[model samples]
Every structure is written in C-alpha cells, then in structure tokens.
Target: MSGPKEELGEQRDSTKKKKKKKKKTESGKKRREKQQEEEGVKGGGGGEEEEEEEGEKQQVEEEEVHSSDCIVLRGIFKLGKKSHDVLLTRTRLTWTPITPEMPTGEACVLQPGVMPLQDVFAVKVKRRRAAGQESGGPVLGVTLFCSRQRGRRLEEDTLHLHNASAEHTYTWYNTLKELVSGFSSRPKCLKVFINPSSHKKEAVHIYREHVAPLFKMADVSTDITVTEKKGHALSVMKECKLDEFDGVVCVGGDGSVAEVCHALVLRAQLDADSPEKPVKPVLPLGIIPAGSTNVVSCSVHGVRDPVTAALHIILGHQQQVDMCSFSSLGQLVCFGFSAMFGFGGQSLARAEKKRWMPSSQRREYALVKTLARLKPEYCHLSFIPVTKTTRDLFGHHSEDEDLDQDPGSVDAEGEGTWTTIKGLYLNISVMSIPCLSPHAPRGLAPNTSLANGSASLIAVGNTSRSEFIKHLKRYSSSSGQFSFSFVETHTVTAVRIRPRSQRSWSEEESEGEEGDSKTTPIIQTEGATFPWNIDGELVEIANEVLIRVHPRLITLYGEDMDEAESTVSCSCI
Candidate 1:
C-alpha cells in the first residue's frame, strides 16, 4: 500500500512543476536576477553552493516529515530494470517508481513496496569487476537484501537496490548490515544435533534441504553432529564447548529434543555447582520437526515445518519455557516439558518395543493395543495446588481474581497446603507447556502455559472402556477432555506419585463389552514396574517419583504463546 511518503513525493513534484512553469513565463535575464536576489536573502549573500546545500537540506526535511520512523537514508535507485526513488527508515525500506512530473507524484501508476527491517538478515553489494582485479566495472552498483517473508510461515525472499554511485551502494549495504546485526536475538552460530534414525530416518535430509540453506543465507554458522545412536546427542552435549554457540538446534522428534534439553539442564547444574537450585541453560534451543509426531515443535512454532523452524532460529526469536524434572530414587531421572503415566506410558513402552516399524504405524499399533488393555494404576498422589485467596474478616470468597489474568504468571504460591488422593487412575498427564500437535490443536493441556511456573495435573479415574474412549476423542478437536466426570484437574507446582507396587489389581471393572478378547479380564502380578512416558520417551520405574515444575528454566527459539497457532490435521484420537 502507498504511504504518506508517496503523497508527499507527488505533491513535491507538482510544486516543482508549478515553479518551472512560472519561471518560464518570466524573461531569462529577469529570472536570473530574481534567483540571485532570493539566493542572497536565503544564503546570506553566499555562493550558489550554499543555496544548493540549503535546498537539499529542505528536501530531506520534507521526506522526514512523512515518516514516523527515523529516516536513515534516501536516494534514487533502479529496481526491476527501472529507476525509482528509494527511502530507508529505521524500521523498513520503501521504494516507489520515479514517474515523470505530471499533475502529481500520485499520477504514477505503479504501487510502492516495503520490506520490514526485522525480516532482512543480510545485505551484499554488487561490483562491476572481479574481486581479485585492480579495478571494478561500474560507478553504480546494486545491493541485494537477503530477507524472509513475514506471516504464518516464513520463506526466503530477496530485494536489490541499484544506485548511480558504487560508494553510495556500499554505504547502503553497510547501513543495512549494521541494522540487521543490531538485532541481538538473532543467532550468529548454532550447535545442531540431527538424529539420523528418527522417524523414517529423514532428519538429515530435512536439515540439508529445508534448514541449511536458510541458515546459510542468514550467515548463521553451525557445528553439526549427525547422531550415531540413542543418547548420542546428550553425550556430545556434555563434552562440547558450550560457549562457542549461541543456541542448540535439535532436528528430530520430541524425544530427541527432550534428551538434548535434559543434557543442557544437567550441564548447567554441574557447572554452577548448584544441583539443588539449578539455573537456566546458557544457550537457547531450536527445534526442527522431522519426526512422526512433532509435538514440541508444533507447540513452540505452531507448525511442524522445518523451514519455519529454521527461520525462527535465524531470527533469534525465543519463548522462555518451563521445564519438568522427574525424580525417582531420590535423584534426578530426566528433564522434559511434559509427561504421561499409566495409559500413555504403557502405550509408549509398547511402541518402543516395535521400533522396527515406521514411527506412525508403531504409534498407531501401540495406541490400539494399549486401548484394548486399558487398566487403571492404583497409586497415591499428592500436590500443592495453586489457589486464589484474599484478606477477609472470616475467609476468602472466590477464586483468585488473577487466575485468568496472565497464564505465564507463576501459579499462586504457598497459599494452600498439599492435597492428597489415593485411587485407581487410568491416565495422568503433567504438562508445563500446551502439548500442541495435529492431533491436539488446542493442546493436551490448555490450562497450563510455557513459563507459568506451574503445570497442569490431570488425573483420569477409572471408567468403562467406552467412556474412556469417548473422553480421548475430545483431545482430537478440543481442550474439554478434562471435563469428564471421572477426571480431576489441578493447577499445581508439584506432583508426587507412588504406585502401589506388588499389589494384584484385577481388571474386571474395565471391561464394558463382554466376549471380546481385547476386553477380557486379566490379573496383575507382584513387583511390577510402572511405565512412564516423559516427553515421548518411555521409562520404567517401580518406586515413587516426583515431578516438579520450574518456571522459565530454558529458552526455545519460537514465537510467544499467544501467537502460537497449531493446525489440526490428524484425527488419530
């Protein structure tokens, strides 16, 4: 769209044309004498150079008046084989065709174009001669701006600014380079981990094709490592020089990302000598979704596209996310953003055993198989709930008025005591960030947030198989899955789960349809290990475990939570 600058340009052109017509009406000798008198008054009897300089300054002021941002530079340049008037502002670069002075500058039929400075990552100047040669080709050169599109998705785009003086072109290039460099969030270098075995083993190809080119255009250096085996990323992270890179890039599924996150958290703790009170990671992380279920990437970037992820990294945009530390046997087990026990854990465990199959098919098989054998885990659970309280003569009246204010705020703390419940639960999920994905567009835990210093604790009590299935279906389309009668939801700072091990629990209550082999009654044995799914990785623990929520513990390259929009495609639920 045309801006005030265009209107002003047109008006300025019209005013000049009127002055020319008026001057033509006067005799040549009279015009020169009138100019000499005006120059004397305006320039204080100085030479023509003084008058010309004053006119240039006035023209610049006119251009400045039409823009809100500080005018950086202005010049005449060629774009698309046509000369145009170009204006650079602190926030954007704009250009318009320099049409002949007719009725007004608005008489120009072509529309103007603008490119936001934030999207421009790099700039380069073109020269006439070879780099090694003593001389160059033309006095004027074109400067190419390497930038990306701004929208739901980001794609690489370029613009060229041509000018008469190569020196001016170089100045434009340098000014743009300095501006792009001033964006402190944009990463200049990254340490990337690509899991070659993730999903159908396409992560390496995705990084090379979709991610590497963007990083190259942005001049973002990378120290890449193609993981050779499981836990390789974590192991390498421990040994690498952390100070050399600005951030870590994980190119795989949530499991691979989780492993790297866990490693970084642990490394930070080790370096700080504060294992008890761990600080946030030194470097932020970027996720490139190349797995079957890109849950973490989907939640952070709102899409599973690798190109979008690469753009976010190059731009250095970030979202401070909460991290969950799962502790068992009185020590840290691992760190993750979300976790699921009972039904979820069992399904993941089943899928882990079927690694020979494609990730999608294995997940589907595990889900179906687990659904058929859905049984509750009898356990003791305790949590410190977030509450809304106020000063009262007797007591507080309602929920915290700020409960709905900012989801990123720490859940009301120390206002209430720990609450405990002992029962048979089918599925329990703890989420710090909304686990957004194609299957759950609203997120698995919509009540929680990325940096809220709290987690959503959802406990699903035992119900008939069909009723549980109906509840699960809600996740495919909405966040009302917790609204079921048998489900209990809480916003809490911590959760402690102690499964009743060595207890034989009969599954007679779970079977709603008789005669089906999948619904047949089964008996449990002693000393059984409970399965846990922490960030898509399965773990087997027979003892009590504590899951604690730490606020803003790690930064991930992404947009803010409010702008995070996920697309729902899979109806697998």
Candidate 2:
C-alpha cells in the first residue's frame, strides 16, 4: 500500500520477524533436548551406582554363606608326618602359612587347603608344663584323631596342637568335641564271641592283649562270650538279643565266623516269617583273625590283621557280602563261604581228624595224605548262569540296583535254564567269596564279587595224578591256577550237585588204598554218605545238595572293593 522504498523496508521487516520467530522456536527445541539429555545422563549414572551397590551386597551375602559363625583360631597343627599353620573354622579347618608378609585382609583372599569338621574323630587334651617352663604353668597340649587320606592311603591320623594357655587349649578341644560329636558317635555296645578252641587256641589271648584295650580306649562296652564247643557260638547267636548291641564280633577262624553268620541269617528268616514282626533286620558282623586260616577275616579286612578289623568296627565302616545257603533234600545243612566235594572234602576231613597234631603240621600232613589218595568222583553238577546286563559285561555293575532276593524260596529246580554237566571231577568247589587265605591268597574263586548275587563253580575234571597234584600246587602260586585244560569255571546263581553212586569210601579204606600204590582204587559200595566240607568244618551228608546265593544278606565291617572287576584272573602279589 506504500511507495517502492517503504514497501521494500516493510518486506525486510517482515522477513526479519519471520527469521526471529524461527530462531526462537529452534532455540526452544534445542533447550528442551539439552534438558532431556542431562536428565538421561543423571538417571543412567544413578542406575549404575545402584547396580554397583547391589553387586556389593550380593558378594557380602555369598561370603556370609561360605564363612561360619565360629571365631577363627590360628595355630600350628602337626598331623601325621607333616605340620602346617592352619585356621580353624566352625565347619572346616583350613591350612595356611603364617607369615609376617601376609596383609591383614589379604590373607583371607588366598585359597587354603581345607579339611571338613566331619572327618575329625576325637580330640585329647594334656595340660602340662612346657619343657623349660615351671611346673603347673600355662603350656597345654592337644591331640586330634581324624580320618585323613595322604596320597593313595586313607587312614586315621593323630594331629598334635600346642597352645600357650590351658583356657585356649580347652577351647580348641571343646570346639573339636562339639564338631565331631555332632556328626559321629562311637559304637556304644558290641556282642563279642571268642572261640576258645579256634586254631592255635589264641583267640582269647589276642583279644585280651590287642583288642580289649582298643575297645576300652574307644569307650565301647562289650558283652564277651567264650564258646565251649563247635556249635556253641551258633546257640549263643540264636538266643542273644540283637537289639541290645550295635554289632556282633567273631574272634576265630572262617568256621566260627560262618557259624555266627549262619545263626543270624536263620534267625532273621524265622523272624521274617513270624506274624508279630515280619521285619528281618540283619546285624552287621565283624571278624578278628585268630585261627589256622582266617579266610573270612582276610577277605573282609584285605589282611589278617585283628587291629585293623577292630579299627574298622570302631570307625563304623560297613560293606555287604553275599551269603551262600546249602540244603539237602529240603533239610538245611549249613551256611558257609565255600562248599567242596571230592578231593577237597576228603582233605578237609583228614585235616579234621588230625586236629590233635600241631596246627601247621596237621594241614600239610592232611594235604599230602589226601593228594596220595586222590581220585575223581563221578557226579552230576547243574547250575543256572547269572543274567548279565550290558553294564555288567563292561565291568560296571551298579551297587544301587535292588538284588536282594530270598535264595531259599527261589526255585532253581523249576525256574530257569540249568546247564548240566556229568563228569568225573577231582574237586568241585562252590565259593560265594574268593575264599582268600594264606594258602590261596588270590582266593580259590579269585574272580568272584562280594555282593554280586552270584557264586563261582570250579570243577576240575578227571586228570592224571601228577596233573592233579600240579593243579593243587597252583593254589600256592599267584598265576596259572585256572589255566589248566582240566579246570573249568562258571559264574552261577544257583547250583545243584547229585552223586550217581550213593557209595562213599571210609578214611581207613582210603588209607589202605593209598598204601597199595600199585593198584588203582575202586569205588566202594559200603557207605552211603560223602564227606562235605562246609567252610573248614566237615560234615557227612548224602552227596546230593542244593546251594543258592543270597545277595547282600549280611554286612561286614571293612573296606569295599572299589571296582567291579573280578580278581580271579589277576595275580594276588
């Protein structure tokens, strides 16, 4: 509406106003964005700080869970052949070095060697004056008994800890006492049976000298019984109150151990069938070797050491073992580790008759005499093979599998396929265990397992006398015992033996036949019973018998075999 110069100036003014409005709007948007960015940075920083605080709290909780509530004690601990300055905690004892260079809080950051409080057995305190200190002074001594493993060997070790004051020493002792007592308690009571007439007649002497002291030291009460005769232990086992004692200990040979086990099993079975209480709780058994051949003790303890067996009992370690039951025509004959016929039975019989002789000389004499009169007995041997799984084939038999079945009720005659063999055999030995002894270190059935629910049937077929003698002698050697062509072995669940002839030769006739070396001995028809050696004891029975294995029927105090492999083919040495 104005002139040209005025119009131009108006246009410039409007343009400048538009530019100012645009600039104001852009600056407002940038200010809002800057405010948002500052708030975001502040929020992120707060979140990071909160996260850092939470992480520190979590670490504190983790430390609380790992550490115990007890006051930490630092001292020098001397154990077995080694010594270390260790930190004693509530749940663990940690070995650490005492050095002036260790910083205050940094010392706990290092990972120290540790032993759990549960492994501690007991602690003894002795408050005496130091060697150079005055009498009744502040020096105190403490010894800790603990189960420890040094390399490949696991055993009980004594740790001696010294302190400056009686109060400090007492505090350590009480701490260990509270820890061990909370976890473990020693066996309070035991029923001990000693066979006075056992091999060497040293059972009583051994118990008095070596065993009784340990029991006293452990504060274990024992009810002692010395059997008068062969079956005396069986009678005692039948009448004893099993609930009153923690375990039963047999101090004798394999024969005596068998008797105690047999009585216990039979009683348990009888109790199981009773209406009042059907539960058959099998008590654990411990064995002390004091006999001519302590095969049971040797097999269980892995050595014929009574002290070791006692320690195992005191420590309360248990391993279950398979039991074998034998019956003749529905009549229970006996329970034993091994059953032998033919030459083996006859040798045992000869040994029994020569009991008046020296224990060492008697067995050697009987073995020689029986070898001279060695003759194979014609019989039918039948057995049912144990069912093997893929895992069993690979030597991985799992112990957790339920294998407990009553062998007496199991019908081996009608249930499964039985492999039958008719032959003249020099020896027929059925072993539940390896039958480990000094004479047969690897055991007669060396490849056998303790709780595998199986037995080993070893049959030596008819062979020449020289070959037979060689086979018998192989038991003394570590190898080649089962390598002979005449020797055959089978893993069996149950076995039945039947003699084709009811005739049995007498010992006198056997001696007479041995005198006449030029003539081959003929089978006699005057007798009807054959000598059966159940463990080391001899019994005359009809040659026919049924034997079956019960798995884990009884528990023995000992270390268990770690691997499932059979050791029969392996050398004992």
Candidate 3:
C-alpha cells in the first residue's frame, strides 16, 4: 500500500531487526559450548552440585555390575613378594577401593607412575578357549603396579592401575582368558588347616618344625590351626570363609583327610548360592601324610615327602577323585580305604589295645595276642550286601547303575557257608597305592588308580591251625612273602559278616582237646550275636556287617616313589 521508496525503507528496517535476532542466537550457542567444556574438565572435582550429579551416573553403572558379581579376593599385599597366580573363570574385572563395599579386600588395581611395584609378585593371566578355537585361546601375562598415596591405607583409597611387565602381563592375560572360559578358578593365596592328632599326637609339631619351612620355600602362605579333638578339623572347615583360599591341605592320616572332604561337600550342599549348585564341592584339597598308614597320600602322589606336596600346592596341579561313606552300627563313618572285617579286623583291634605299651612291646603283644584269637573256638561270622536303592544315600558312584553294580557272581557263596577249622583269620586289605606292604613285593590292588571309582577286595580264608602258623612266619620275612595258596580276592559292592558260637575250653577242656584232631560240624543259619572286627578294631555286632569301597574322594601329596624301586639317591632334599 506504500510508495516504492517507502516500501524499500520498511524492508531494510525489517532486515536489520532479523540480523539483531540472529546475532543473539549465535551468542547463546557460544555460551552453552563454553559451559559444557568447563563442566567436562572439572567433572571429577567440581562443586557439590556437579559432584552429586556425576556420582549418580557412577552409581547406576556399579549397580549393574554388582547384580551379577561372582569373583572375590582377600589376602595380604606387600611390596617385593613373589607374584602368585590367580586362575579365574567367567568373571570380569571391576575396580573398587579397598572398603567394606568390596567383597574381596584387595587394595586396588595397581597403577603405573603411582608407586614402585618392583617387589609385588608377578602376575600371570590366561583365558579358556572359545567353541571354535578350543586349543589356542587367550593367554596374557601382567606385571601389576601399585599406585602412590602418601599415608593412605590400601584399604581406604581408590587406586589407579597399569599393566605389569611385558612377560608377566602376557602370561596373566593368557591365563585369565583360559580361566574365564573354563569351569574352575584358583586364587593366589590359600589357608591351610592341619590336623596334629592324626597318626600320633605329634602331627602339629612335625608339620610346623619340618613342613612349614618347605611351604614357605614354595611361596605358599598358610594359616595353620591344630585340631584339638576328633572332628575338630571338620568344624573349622565348615565355619571358615572358603572363597578366600585357593585350596586347603591336611597334614594327617586318611581319617583327617576324610573329615575335610566331608565338611567341604556338606557345606556346599547347604549354601544357597553355591557355584556348583546342587552338586558336590569342587574345591580342590591337598594332604600331607602324618599318619601311621597314609594310604591315601601314598596312593595319589606316590611319596611321603611333605616338601614335594607343598610344591604341588603352589603349582596348582589338580585331579578329580572319588569318595565313599558308609554306616556301621547305625553310625555314619567315612573311610579313604577299605573297612577290614576278618583277621584284618582282629589284628587292628589287638594293635590298638597294646598301643599304651612300649613300641616293641606293642608290636610283640599284638602279634602274639592276635595269634591266640585266630582259633575258631570262639566266634562265627557272615557277610551281607546292601541293596542298590539303599546304597544311593551315602554313595559316590556315577549315575549309571551298571558301573556301580556289584560285579561278583553269587554262585560261589552257597558252596562255602562255613569255614570250619581250628583257627579263623581275615584280612580286609584295601590298596590305593601300588605298594601296600613296604619292603615286600605284595600290593593290595596294583591295577587301580587313585581317582578310579572302585576298590579291590582281598581276603584271607584259611582255618587250619598249622597253615595259620606257617602263614604267620611269612610276615616276619620283611618281604611279606605270604603263602598265597589259601588267599582269595573278590570284587564285590559290599560284604556282610555274621559269626556263630565256637567251642572254648576252660584250660582243662583245652588240655583234653590238645591231642584231639576231630573236626567240628557246621551250625545252621540262625540268629546269633557275633564279634566283628573292622580294620583291626573289634566290636561285637548282630550276625551281619556291611562294607563298601570308595574309589577317589581326595588328593594326596607324598614322596615321588614309583611302583618299581629305582636306585635314585633318596634324600629329603
């Protein structure tokens, strides 16, 4: 509606207004960019408002990791110590300050340029393989460094970290990779619980004075607790925090070893969040023989050397073994070896009864006393097997019933109802090691492995007085050259024994029967109380006793002896 000149002036004025508005918008954008840059620079140490905002972000991230957390660690960390290996599986690393919030009391991930990490043990990492690359997976070695914090307790500070030495870092990387892909994890440190009352009442002193130094040499740290009484070791194991240790070792006989296995397995069953859910304890255990008959250790490691065993602990050598539990006289009892019932039973009892005597007196008395009891003039016995369904309760057999089924034939039992004679002797010999009799060529079960899920059963089934006397002489040869003519070896799931009354003379009756060579008739299969012997210990039981074998329940460490003696200079060194 305006003239041309007036319209041009109005349009120019409008363009000026638009330019002003554009300048203001550009200024606003510049201000926002500057503010954002400043915030990012000071985000870690800004004012309270900014700190609160940043803290919220970190919290959300940590909550995500904690939801699925699985790994934990706790141990001493000092400068310049040998680097120990920690094998991990299916876990991720999350940095946390050494505080209550951190399940594992590890100080922090060491950082480069913070502190001198020259002394801490080197780190080795390895990874398990993937489905396609099973053989050549991930492996890395790391040399962890520590951060510098003046006067700050490792437990209180958040830390920075860096890669370890080149070689160490590579090894650790590889190891960690392997572990995360595998089924088991081994920590860097272990807590050791040793039983001092196993074989003799001197296990504690023996381990401390002789074995502790060896473990130290192998760079293994241990917190030893000497058991005060029977089953004391098991109680400690049940109560201790097992996740903190890499493994556990026992320094006693098979009895002490059995206690540890039972405790671990039982606790695993009770734990709601157990890794091996609804299954047995996969925690590896070690043993050092301090017992008189260390069959378990001898069987697994082939030696009795404490030092060698300690080395194995540090090395983290592992193998799966089987364990068996049984009930005797309504009491649950676990044995690493077979339960002896016949002459083996009576002999064990005699040996224990004469224990208070002098060593020489004990041996002499046990031999003479058991010889007198071998006469068939006092007791009758029978053997019975537990049914398959009932045996499942306290058994370690595989799920396949065929593998656990008793392999012996039933046809032989009917022909030998009663072993009538003037003397009765039995041996419940079970062998896990190659050499059951030292200084002799005889072994209980030479073909079995330590982890095999079966046991060998050997018995002495002779009743002739003269033959008994002859067999007794063979034991004195130091070679255990027994007359094998009358012995029997049968593999069965279990055996039960019931004994009957035998004729006894009141000294005068014995005098009359001394010259009499007459044989006695067999008794009927009726109910009668009989004295049964278990591993040389005697206990009177109702006519039947049941026994079963456990193949491999634990790991043992001993001297590196061989099946055939080799002329290697044998020294504790």
Candidate 4:
C-alpha cells in the first residue's frame, strides 16, 4: 500500500491534470452555455433539493468510510514473492487493479468488477526511510483474512460459494483491518498490604511465608506493605496508585478488612463523577486471615488457611460483597459484621479488653468469669428489622430462614422495632458467614450471605441467668444448645440502659400485686455506663447510644460459596 506521503504526491499530480483540462475549456461559448443553464435553475426549489441530496450522500460516504480509524488492506501484484490471497464480505469494500506495477501512490485501472471473496492477491513490503535518507528497516508481514468459506477453497473446489458444497475457495485481502489485539494481556502483579499491628502479628509472617509463593507461581508480581499503626493499611490503600497493579490483597483480621473496605468505598465515591453513577472505579480485594477473628475472610472464602486464601487470590476471581456502614454519634464506621449495644456490647467489650492476655488464657478467663457472674440485664431497644416485620416480631425466623425484601427499603422509622433484651450480652452483627461459634458446627445466622442486603441478628432476650450461661457455653462447645434464629434486621437508633437499684430482685415484685403497676422497679434509666461492641471490639457509651445500618453502603469481594451451601437476599449479598 502507498504511504500517506506518496498518496499526497499523487493527488497533486491529479490536480495539475484537472487544471490543464479547465484551461482547455476556457472558451467563451462553453462558459456562456454553462452560465445560461445555471441561471435557468437558480430560481427553482428542485435545484436546491438536488444539491442538498448530493451533499447528504457525500456525508454518508465519509461517515461510513471513516467511521472508525480507517485501515485498508492492500497487496502487490507484480513480481509476487508469495501467493497471498484475500477474502472479503459484501459489507466490505474490495477491488483489484489491472496494472501489476504502479508507482506507490499512482492509481491503476480497476479490474472492471469487485474481486471474488476467494481471490488471492500477492503482497510486497516497501520500507521507506526519512526524506533525503536511505536505510533498511524491519520487514512487515502481510496475511490475507478470509472467511471460512473462502479459505476452504484450498481444500476442495466445491467450497467456493457461501454455501457451496463441492466448490473450493481461496483467501484474499483488500484493505487493512482495524483490529485491537492487546485486551487479553495477563496482569503484571499484585500489591499486597498487610496489617501487622492488627489483633495478632502472625498475619505478616503468614502471608510472607505461605501466600507470596503461590501468587508468584501464578505470575502475579507483588509489592508488600506492612502496616505499623491503626488505619495505616487504609491510608496506604487510599494513597496507592490503584491502576499500577491488577488487584489488592489484605492479610489480617476483620478490622484490617474493614480498613480496606472503607478506603475502597471512599476511593470509589471519589472516582465517580456523579452520586448517581454506578460503581466505576472498583478494585477487587483478596483477603488473607491473620487476626483474632477472620470473619470477613472466613465468610467470603470457606477456609481460614492463609495458603488457601492466597490461592483464591491467584485465581483472580472477583465478586461484589455487601458491607454495612454504621453511624454512631455522627461518626461513620463500616463494619463487615454487626455492631452491638447493651448486654451483647458489654460481653464483647469485656472479651476484647482481655486480649492483652494470651489467647488460651483469655478464652479460659472469659469463660470462667462470665459463668461465675452470669446475670440477666434488661434494656429497651428500638430496632428496625431489614427483613419482613411479622417474621422478625416473634422470632420464628430460624438461623437458616430465607426471606426477600426491597433492596433499598429503609422504612419511615428505618424498619424499626423495639424490644427489651434480658441477658447481659447485647449483639448486633452484619454477618456474612455461617458458624460464628468456633467450636460449634452451627452458625448463629446461617442464612446470612456475604452480599445480602440485610444483616442477620441473633440477640438473646432477657432470659434466666442459667439460660444466658448455656448460650455463652455454645461458643466454645460443639454440643451446647442455644436458639440462634434470624430475626427482623434491627438497627439501634438509641438504647436506654437502666441498672436495677437493688442488685437482688424482690419476691413481692415477682408476685402480681395491686401496686405492681405503680411500682417503678429497681432499675432506672440513669447513672449507668454501657459498654458497646462493634465487630467484637468494645467501647463504652453513655446511658443512651444511637446506631443505624447503612445497607450495601460498602463493597468487598465476596468469594464464591456454592448455591447448595448458602443463599443471598435482594441481590445485595
């Protein structure tokens, strides 16, 4: 094919020929006739319509020929070195020239008709150096792109026509095909951020010794950044160049995962041009477990093994998982699991406070201390169930229950419900996995899916002290029995905790008395500090605390858990 420079030169020569023809037609007689005809049509509307039609045709041709970056397939005919062939469709423009040797940009006479789809044309390479210079360059390879029908001509003569059964065909090329061929390139590497300061420092070592090797095998490069302080991992993620790598991997527990999720959500929001824009700049996340609780990792991928998690990273599968955002005292926090207030809050707060002790020691201590001091406390809570209200009211919803609700439904009170939980432990969970109890095979909220729109809440009501002890025992024993049914999703708008003035209950109050209605009871809504649990971490709040669930407010990578094993709600999960 002629280069653009050569084609321009040919056009100049053609313009010169046109000028010569105009000079020859400069006679007064011919010019006068043309003027007379133009004057005759000047007053008519038909003449203007004809001109407009011609202009429209030219625009259509330009649009069709130059729609995308134009590429034309061409070939050499004279002194052909190889038997090159071309095939083209009716939708394609194709032709052959009569002269075998035309100067690069000079046009040759068309061969009177379009070339057959099976026709073959020989191509030659013409490498050109800079103007006023001469040098050899790389030779370009040219091949014919033909339909299967045309290519089949080489095998059998009967395959010439589109549906010909007996005819053979040959391939041909007429114009350069504009095709992009770089979309399938493999990811160069991954950027891994590990939080060593998390619950346990084993995460960094675990990822280095176990996870890195597998990613290397999969040809994913790695840039490891170990966090040193709280929110350090999230900071790195926010500052990192997201496009430099294929994906991001986090090694640590739920807190670390929460950090990553928050950063990602913020980044996503920043990258989007409008609030209404669907997710635009999402980067997939991989999780490696290295914390006191690897809830997010465990829920997404069935196993907690660091090596197994790393393998999932190597596989490079991505999923959109649900993350709940909570607003407490105007401060927003995104948690992979539920948040707690009241008794559940107190229990988790106590458990986390003991983390300074060794794991075995802490577990033993928590178990013994909780049992010895088993007691039931009560708090009036306002909850808005994310699921159906009727099912959530009586708690017929089991741990394995599946229900559907609006994806964006936040009721007038935000699906609110009110109840008084009796036990000392108050829990709110945005669970994504089954089997929260370490020792028991049973999951407190089995139906909770990773990307589900709603959260699973299993709160122990104000039951007897013995009952509370049994519920606590279930966490460390496989056979401990406790009812952990799914209830209407609950959000803690505000909780009022009142401790009983007298530590012990009065027998007279227990019996139905005439003054029972007037009696205020020992507990009053005053002078009490309530410890709260957010994803198993404890924080102390004043007498009243307010919380609300932000549905699908954050995003994470939800690993594939087979359909036979679990289900999701409203596609959020």
Candidate number with greatest lDDT: 1
lDDT of 4 by residue, 289-394 (tens): 7876565665565555675566545544355565555444444434435555544554443455465677546655655544454454443334444434433434
The 0-to-1 C-alpha lDDT of every candidate, in the order given, reads: 0.76, 0.71, 0.46, 0.48
TM-scores of the candidates in the order shown: 0.76, 0.72, 0.50, 0.52
The clash numbers for all candidates, in the given order, read 3, 2, 69, 44
Tens digits of per-residue lDDT for model 3 on 58-137?
99989777753544332222123433223222343333223233467554454322222121212323344677875654
Clash count for candidate 3 is 69
Which scores higher on TM-score, 3 or 4?
4
The residue-level lDDT of candidate 3 at 476 comes to: 27
Sorted by TM-score (best first), the order is 1, 2, 4, 3
Residues 79-173 of candidate 2: C-alpha lDDT, one tens digit per residue: 43445577787778777545454555454344567777655556778556658864465445677766665422236666677655677777777
lDDT of 2 at 172: 76
Q: By TM-score, how accurate is candidate 4?
A: 0.52
- What does the lDDT come to for candidate 3? 0.46
lDDT of 1 at 183: 89
